[model samples]
Target: MALEDIPRLGCGRSIDRIWGTIDRPPTAHEEQCDQCQTARTRLRRLSKATRSLRESDLHNPTMEPRPGIKNAIMDVVRAKVRRGSRILLRSADNGTTEISEQALSSLIRSAAAAIPGVHSRRCRIEIRSAAASVADEDHPTGTTGTSTNAGPRLIINLRVAAAPGIVIPRTVEALRHEISNAIPASVGIGAGTVNITVEDLYDV
Candidate 1:
């Protein structure tokens, strides 16, 4: 059938020609052919009904969806079931690596002991295991992932007695960095955050 003789679909291309190309305009033939004309009329009616339904939905919004509702619903469902877990790593080299609260306390005490002026007895360390989500695969390496061997993330609280002349901010910052580095390296898990609390100031 000549392209022009074929009935034009709503898009302006002939029905036969536009069969595979849904986006194509209807052809002149399609506009004139009785069968094509009826098909086009029916399609137009359906389109109008669809649009009217959408308008009615907006006017008297029903729980029923318009078009892309299925996708949106699926996205919400997937988000709810997404998994979150943590991986912790421990160092084999140092006898220092420990998972228990007491073990962590001992580790911190030992670290404080190494600091020249810090008193081992006066310093207190509390360690707790906390859960945190692993980063998506798109995240950079070492960013977030649970190690099978390592436990969940660790939170360490260091309360130390500092001398009157000590720079608390500097000391805290230093301790934060040191602890962050040491914990992750010694235990095979990523550290989400490190916080150091200097609870007391002692004149020494």
Candidate 2:
């Protein structure tokens, strides 16, 4: 498989392995796979960029995300979850308004982005309906499918780069709190579970 097979061949576990978060060794298939190698190279580049960002932050503690960063993130989210459907929110007139998964994801991303020393990178949202037994297993940036149903519960998963010198647990807690609060206000739906993962560490 080549790089184009990423959606089919490579998933989040491959990324976890690249980040050293996964302890297991790669299988023979993965070790000999061209797609995995390509993914590794790209992921390594991303890791290096985060390190460069850390160095820059050490020199400038007050630095902020550059212009268009949020837009770039949104672009990536949209491309990843284009197959997903929109969510329906209750309105005062006994009507329902549709909120795209991408929009809800933006809210979650914004919540994390507001925190100092945190750079929100990826946000995945799953909406589970009462008729369904479980939430959708598909992750947007990962090799999983996404689903949408009306009046479903929302589960948000966010990946961020935490700056050095910041408390990890506290930072994650802050993201969860802010994201939970932002959901109902923005889309009129209660957030179910807010999962935060610190994928990389940068400088403050």
Top candidate when judged by lDDT against the true structure? 2
Let me know the TM-score candidate 2 reaches against the reference structure: 0.52
Q: Estimate each model's TM-score.
A: 0.38, 0.52
lDDT, candidates in the order shown: 0.53, 0.72
Q: Can you tell me which runs of candidate 2 are displaced by over 4 Å?
A: 1-84, 91-95, 131-150
Give model 1's TM-score versus the native structure: 0.38
How much does each candidate deviate from the true structure in C-alpha RMSD?
18.6, 18.5
Model 2 Cα shift for residue 91 (angstroms): 7.5
lDDT of 1 at 120: 34
